[model samples]
Target: MPATRALVLAAAVICLAAAGWLVLREATDPGLAAHPVPGMGEMNAAELSRDGYLVIPAMLREVYVAFGATEEAVIHDTLAAVAAGPALETLYLDRAGAMAGGGLDGADQEIHEMELLDLASSRDGAMLSVNATWRVLGTVGHAEHMHVRGNVYSAALTLAPTAAGWRITGFELLDVDRSDAGTMVAAPEPAEATGG
Candidate 1:
């Protein structure tokens, strides 16, 4: 009976220690510590401030995919929804408007990988530098189809606080590495340049 009690106590102590370890891990985890509440649309500024590392990458992916949309409405609306201020103007003037004669009619973009390289935050806003590996597939224009894969680029972005959420306020493309076989390479451009 005494041995049985000792065994039960040991088991209980082990379980408690495991639970405590899990709690400690979660508390220290940057991703989980700042994780925002999951919802239907974009996370707002407050949420972004809490967890820019997690939110910004996903947002960029959405913007990249939206750029490939053939419909002008989709292009404009998607950009407008994700960006504001200088960033929005850049997207309209440089990216969406710069489409070749036919635009990205059948173009599709895929982000193979994205990493948050750096982040700087202030009371009013934040900045991020990101590196991504992406590819574009399908016909972007007559004789201008894109088939690049493993293309890489780095982008610098500025975010400002807004009532809706943290909106992209500025964007700049820092560098690019095109694939050797790239035909019509498409890169992720800033303001110049996502998620629901």
Candidate 2:
């Protein structure tokens, strides 16, 4: 009778050991690459530090909108500028990965490159001495009448974090130097010199 009891106890121990191994494997799997972004249910500023850079693509869109590149990039008889808007929107939405599913035109659409270097609280962050550079150029549909190319542009701005998320509290965009932020001008042909 004692031998029977011992055999049952040993089987139970083996089962528990196997379950533990499976849990450890899932937690330590590096190649699988899980839990990149934390969602609302996942955590807040406490467990994960709200001061972290919750890099949402929408914030980047807000900056783009503030710059108003849509009108500048497009020219008469050209489609490049018009297409860039939707394409830019697509790029930002993908940053959230598959878990985010898709992005809508709301608070989620206003986030961009949010590299939170400091976290004052789980609900707030500050970036007074922040440097940021973003460049995006994409073709619009299929058009041969124009080209979409420009020099790199950089700027510095101070961003702040709030309950809604990170925001540009204050910023100064110095000389663009040489940027093709659209605003292309057409060239004129010279008049006949014989009459002169």
Candidate 3:
């Protein structure tokens, strides 16, 4: 009888410890912005924030995947690959739109490497703000390319949540021009240009 009681107590303690570990991990690790269950999108910002601040990461991840995946080399023969990963998407992003400019094309990392440092994100009502430092390093048309770095770029975007949690619908990139600036050499200047 005593053995049975001890076994039950050990099991309960182990279960409790595991649960506590999961909660702590989720609170600290900014990477897993996953909403395993469908969020009740009917709630307002305050309500959503109450349930672990899920909106910001979800919206940001979508943007990262969308933007990072598309890359075409410029006049230079150099290649740039952008991927949507923890380095840029899940963790390491800031309220100022700060994130690493990763050249990750799905699983394929681009030859032309670009990284965004000190990335941040902010939300004003339905509008989400992204700011980050831009750095470009790799080969241009030549073999060595040009080792260059620039300041942070700011972007103000409007985000919306569908049944699939939060995703960016309409966004206004105030200073940065996505068409031409999204490149290796002739890309947008840095945070200063965008007033980030």
Q: Best candidate per lDDT, number? A: 1
Model 1 Cα lDDT, one tens digit per residue, 48-135 = 5556566666666667666767677787777766677888788766655656643555555554455555555433323333333333
- Residue range 72-161, candidate 3, lDDT tens digits: 322011111111222223222321122134433332212243444444565555333444334333322222232232323344433333
State which candidate, 2 or 3, has the greater lDDT.
3
Q: After superposition, how far is residue 166 of candidate 2 from its true place, in Å?
A: 1.6
Runs in model 1 deviating more than 4 A are 1-50, 101-104, 108-146, 179-196
Kindly list the per-residue Cα lDDT of model 2 for residues 84-146, writing each as its tens digit. Answer: 243334433333242144322222212222332222322232223344454555321111122
Name the TM-score of candidate 3. 0.30
Worst 10 residues of 1 by lDDT: 31-40
TM-score of each: 0.53, 0.31, 0.30
Looking at candidate 3, the ten consecutive residues that score lowest on lDDT are 75-84
Candidate 1 vs 2: which has more lDDT:
1
Using TM-score as the measure, name the better of candidate 2 and candidate 3: 2
Task: For candidate 2, give the lDDT.
Answer: 0.36
Residue runs of model 3 more than 4 Å from their true location after superposition: 1-43, 47-58, 70-151, 177-196
RMSD of 3: 14.9
